[model samples]
Target: MNKVIRIFIKDSTLIPVISIVLGLLIGALIMLLGAYNPIRAYASLIEKAFGDLYSIGETIRQITPLIFTGLSVAFAFRIGLFNIGAEGQFIIGSVTAAFVGIQFDLPWYIHVPFAVVAGGIAGGLWGSLAGLLKVYRGVHEVIATIMLNWIALYLSNYIVKFFLIEPGQQRSRILSDSSWLSSSWLSQLFDGARIHYGILLGLICTFLFYVILWKTRQGYELRAVGYNPDASEYAGIHVKKNIVRSMMVSGVFAGLGGASEVLGVFHYQTIHSVFPGHGFEGIAVALLGGNTAVGTILGAVLFGVLTFGATGMKFGAGVPIEIINIVIALVIFFVAASGLVKAIIDKVKKKIISGGSSLPTSQDWKKGV
Candidate 1:
């Protein structure tokens, strides 16, 4: 029994599970301080997120982009790069898809794929810029990605406003039916929800990430280069090439995420003053999932639930939506600080088993003299 318990504690999954619980507990404390009932708020959240078919579809719709962006971050992390520019890549992909979606009118099958591929390519090129800067100019990836994010944002705004704008509207022209990924059958099945085929595409991408990384020679080389560029170079691997490739792939995923938004959900592009923030959220998902393919998928689902339910929480339970953010922040905090939390837990367990009377003050102080 003790051995089993020890193994459970040592398991990789245990840390994330504990962190999630701890975050919820802390969030509950915050809710209490705010004079809100945490139990009622959480129950309402669950009800609105999964109670009905429509809600479930909304949850999956929310999960789709998260899966792509999470995989984008996780994929880059595997290759020793910090892709802070998934937002930029995402924006670029969205606009490129929007451009293709509006400019050409092809068959449904061809048009949909053409727009999606355009988004992926645009994102890949955008992501590769950071990689090029890192490998050639010796610029740090973090700094390059951060700058690229802003550049992508402004570039996207310009493309939409100056080039892609409709004659009389503020947003880009609505995509024709052929360009949409929406499934009539699926929407009917879910009682008129906006869930589309993009979720399936996202899942396919996740599977590809797993297979390419763990089963292919290219993936092996990429991982090798990531582990140690000097050693990989000695082993006849082109480290620079792999670095560029990884970033492009990362951007591809993020770009697809953006394309999913346009083709699957919004169906049009709007001018934006700020980044959509999906890239940064991807960082949180990657960290929570320990940067694994399956873990990232599950993490995205968890975040999706919280995000889709936030509205219900605000309206139904009168709880602030910021509570969800607080919980997410705490979960990341506890994951990052797992060792400290574990040490504290171990000390408490030891004290319980040993029946130790250890105290910071003296024995006399405890004796109530």
Candidate 2:
């Protein structure tokens, strides 16, 4: 019984599962209130998410950037920084990649990686700018990053208009064929799939982030510094340096995500309507994932599925897809107040373990503080 209790308390994946399940349960309640059949609605939702080739491809496409964004947010959170500028960083990364993607013509093998890596570097620099201001000048990242986002939005628009613009058009010229990631490179098994090799890049990055956070010395120091910076300073960790570096890493992850969207989905420079909600979505994903690499990826996929399925819920049952956002909000609320949920669950689990007996009286509960 103690072992089971400990496993429930310590298993990282269990909490996120509970959060998601609770969110879905609450969503069903909302459906019930709307006079819609909740089970049927959910069934339709699943069908739409995986129904056909095009649906599956689109689902994968939507999930691609999420993996990067989720990891980006998760990485920053581990260092106690709230990186609200992921949207800006993400757009800048894409803009940088687009410029590089079209500026020079090289072999596909060389150009693709070059464009992608350049995007990451550009994003990292952008993120570090905020980090630098935060650490050196005592400016809050939340404020600085948000301001930078507005600057980035306008800058991206101007760049696309003046430099990358196609003569008189809003968009740049089509990227060279060599720079494109052809679906033909995939085997006939996924023959008509629009899912590209960018998915592989995201997955590889996720794994590397996992190793960095869990198996490396730097990871230990990062968590320590985040938890108690004063203590970490006394313990020889450079808290400020770690803060800046972590944010830079966060931006790189976001940048890579932007590249995935541009190279895999857009294929050319675009402006006037750069939708960056995905970067903001990563915040919810990170919260749900509990800031672990594996957990973050799972959270990203779950969100992708939710977003994918919400459209069907909207069209089929006349339900607003915004309800999905409500569900996410509820999950964040509970996770932020985790102590309450944990205490309640502990009471139920203890009761079960004791075969319905009451826990020891208060007078008998002096084992540990």
User: Which candidate number would show the highest TM-score if scored against the true structure?
Assistant: 1
lDDT of 2 by residue, 211-285 (tens): 887789888888888788899999999988998999999999998888777877778867757566878888888
> Would you list the C-alpha lDDT of every candidate in the order shown?
0.87, 0.81
Name the top lDDT candidate.
1
Q: Model 2's lDDT to the true fold?
A: 0.81
Residue-level lDDT tens digits of model 1 in 69-166: 99999889988898988888999999899989988999988999999999999999999999999999999999999999998888888888887788
Q: How accurate is candidate 1 locally (lDDT)?
A: 0.87
Indicate the residue-level lDDT of 169 in model 2: 72
Span of 10 residues, lowest total lDDT, candidate 1: 360-369
Instruction: Please report how far candidate 2 places residue 188 from its true position, in Å.
Output: 5.4
Range of the 10 consecutive residues with the lowest summed lDDT in candidate 2: 360-369
CA deviation > 4 Å runs, candidate 1: 1-8, 167-169, 348-369
Q: Over 4 Å off in model 2, which ranges? A: 1-14, 167-170, 185-188, 272-274, 343-369
